[model samples]
Target: MGIWLGALRRPLLRALPTALGVVLLNFALLQLVPGDAVDALVAEAGSATAETTALLRERYGLDQSSWHQLGDYLQHLLHLSLGYSPRYDMPVLDLLLARLPNTLLLMGAALVISLTLGVALGTVMATWARRWPDRLLSSLAFLMYSTPGFWVGLMAIVLFAVQLGWLPSGGDGTVGAELHGWERFTDTLRHAVLPACTLASFFVAVYARLTRAAILEVQTQDYVRTARAKGLHPVRVRLRHILRNALLPVTTVAGTHLGGLLGGAAVTETVFSWSGIGRLTLEAVQAREYRVLLGVLLLSSLLVIVANVLIDLLHARLDPRIRAT
Candidate 1:
């Protein structure tokens, strides 16, 4: 318990400054862009009088200097307020909270699929080593790793949704359906299938290759040789000795990949029209909603920080050497 708490404390300490830096960087970078939300609104409305444009800019604080805006934004952060989203005409916090679950769901599903399948495929590749099975699986992993995720999503929609009618093409769930309980669950899962698989494809390839290399490397260790010499069952030795240690690298890689998963979700959500933070982020970007964008960036940075902290704890738990250190 003490060890875990110590591990947790360290990351928590670092997260504050890291999150602040992210906010400042995102804010500064957005300021560099030529337009603001008012510009987008004016374009959408097709025209606005000079007075009307000035009033609109004043209304959203766009008329303020960048430094002034930054000070105000930081003030809002201190108050736990994400400020307003002119794009959605709501509080940025509210907008994000509403969409966060869908994004988390998509991310969770993709992570599970990728880790499970990647680890299994990698184990198979490692077990087969120089044989045809290893060669075949390695080729597949490379193909998947190289293929773009959006293209995979499009192909999936074409085959499964459009042509075969096996799944819905887009959106998080059925529109206007009065689904309840198990029925609703199944419907949601069905809708998720394509997007989840599409998102997981590249990651699955990555983890599979990683796990294969880790396992192969571990198999050559002195501990593994000793386990074999002790005449333990082949399966037991492989599982208990080789695979367990092999997972350390995989776990570390997975932790680092969580942030990438969120980034990928933006593309995936756009592709599938999932009502997640990722899609909201795209809308925010398009509308030049810097407040909303900053909120999202801050939240994302915090999430990654928290996730890596948890990963560190898990790593220590898995490897006694880490715990000792």
Candidate 2:
């Protein structure tokens, strides 16, 4: 256990600086944009006198030079205070915290669906050889992987929501419906079906293909044949040896995909018209809500960094070969 923990220490320590660099880079680019958050508010406020605009700018420290502003921003970040939102008129961290759970629900559901179905389907294909199930599932998985998430989302809405009236068109739950316990869950699930399916379909394809290839390769190794030759049942050989080795690569692939899942959720949310962080991020961009954009970028970068570190640890555990490093 001590050795295993020691192996993880260096990788995590290295990832910290890389994540910080990403946050700083994103902050720098956003600051370099043509205007700041104060200007957007001034423009939207329209009739505001120049004096009022000047006061607002000073109040928010937008009056500071680029270097001073960045320094202040970094100071606030160090304290875990993301600052206030000019548009939302609330604390940045509070706003994000409120919306994060909803976003997690949508993305989390899709991830769950993808991992379960993708692994099972992939294992089935690799184990079944040229059977009809393998051929059919492979073809379907290919189609899903090729199709765009947004396009798939739209098709689902048009077919199931609009045409068949099977689900709500968009947005959060109805008036008092969300106030009820299970009712909210049911409502959210119905609304989530299209978006989740759209997101999961592609992931399912990617994971299935990756797992199938990994398993197929592992199944042909000399040790695997020896296991079979030793009179172990075919199922036992495949499950204990082939599947275990195949999973090592799958764990790595899944870890790599965590970032993509967070990023891709934006497109899925837009298509489904869900009010999750992805949708919030889109609205922030349209409104030029600089602070909100900053928050989203920071949160995403941090999540990705955390995911990569976790994946590295998992990879080491799954494959003892990594321990030699």
Candidate 3:
């Protein structure tokens, strides 16, 4: 209990400085973007005189020095203010919060599907070893891993939604349908299938390969040999002794892949028209919505850091040897 508590504490303590660094980095990089929200708005409003543009810049404080802007941003951040999105004419944080749940739902579903299916298929392949089933699984994993996510999403929409009319092509739910109870639940899921599967494909391949390798490595260990020699059932030996130990690497890999998953989700979200952070990011980039972009990047970086810290704690729990280190 003490160890577990310590594990949690250490990460929380370390996260503060790391988060501040992310904020600074995101702010600095956002400044490098080619345009600003004022310019975007001005362009959209048609021809603007020099004086009008100057007033617009002054109104938004776009005339301030970069360093001064950073200082103001940091000050506001201390009070949990994410600043306003001039493009959307709202608080940046509110805009993000609105879309956050959708992104989380997509990412959570994809991760669960990938990890569950990958582990199962990988275990089957490892058990079968050099058999045809193993070869087939390996080939599928390779193919999925090599394919691009957006392309897969487009093809899936074309086949499943457009041609077959099996699933809704895009959006969070059925349009104009005041769905209640089960209908509402299923409708969201129905819309999620293509996007989730598309997001999970590459990750499924990753986890499968990792699991296969880890299981094979664990199989050769003396403890596994002992379990087999002690007359344990083959199933018991594989499940209790082999798979448990093999999962450590999979957990680590999953943690490492979280950021990539978010990145891919952006592409997938755009392709599927999902109203998630990824799509928001794409729009922000195009419109040069600096505050929104920075907020998204900072939030994403923080999530990745927190996930890695949790993974480390989980690793410690799974293998006490890590706690000692």
Candidate 1, pairs of clashing residues: none
lDDT tens digits, residues 165-254, model 1? 999999988999999999998998999889999999999999999999999999999989999999999999989999999999998999
lDDT for each of the candidates? 0.91, 0.81, 0.91
Give the lDDT of residue 279 in candidate 1. 87
Per residue, candidate 3 scores C-alpha lDDT tens digits across 216-249 of 9999999899999999999899888899889999
Best by lDDT: 1
Clashing pairs in 2: none
Steric clashes per prediction: 0, 0, 0
How much does each candidate deviate from the true structure in C-alpha RMSD?
1.2, 2.3, 1.5
Off by over 4 Å in 2: 1-4, 128-133, 178-183, 323-325
Candidate 3 regions exceeding 4 Å error are 180-182, 323-325
Regarding lDDT, does 2 or 3 come out ahead? 3
- Total residue pair clashes for candidate 3: 0
Which residue runs does candidate 1 get wrong by more than 4 Å?
A: none
Q: Candidate 3: TM-score?
A: 0.95
TM-score, cand. 1 vs. native: 0.97
Residue 140 of model 1 has an lDDT of: 98
TM-score to true structure, per model: 0.97, 0.90, 0.95
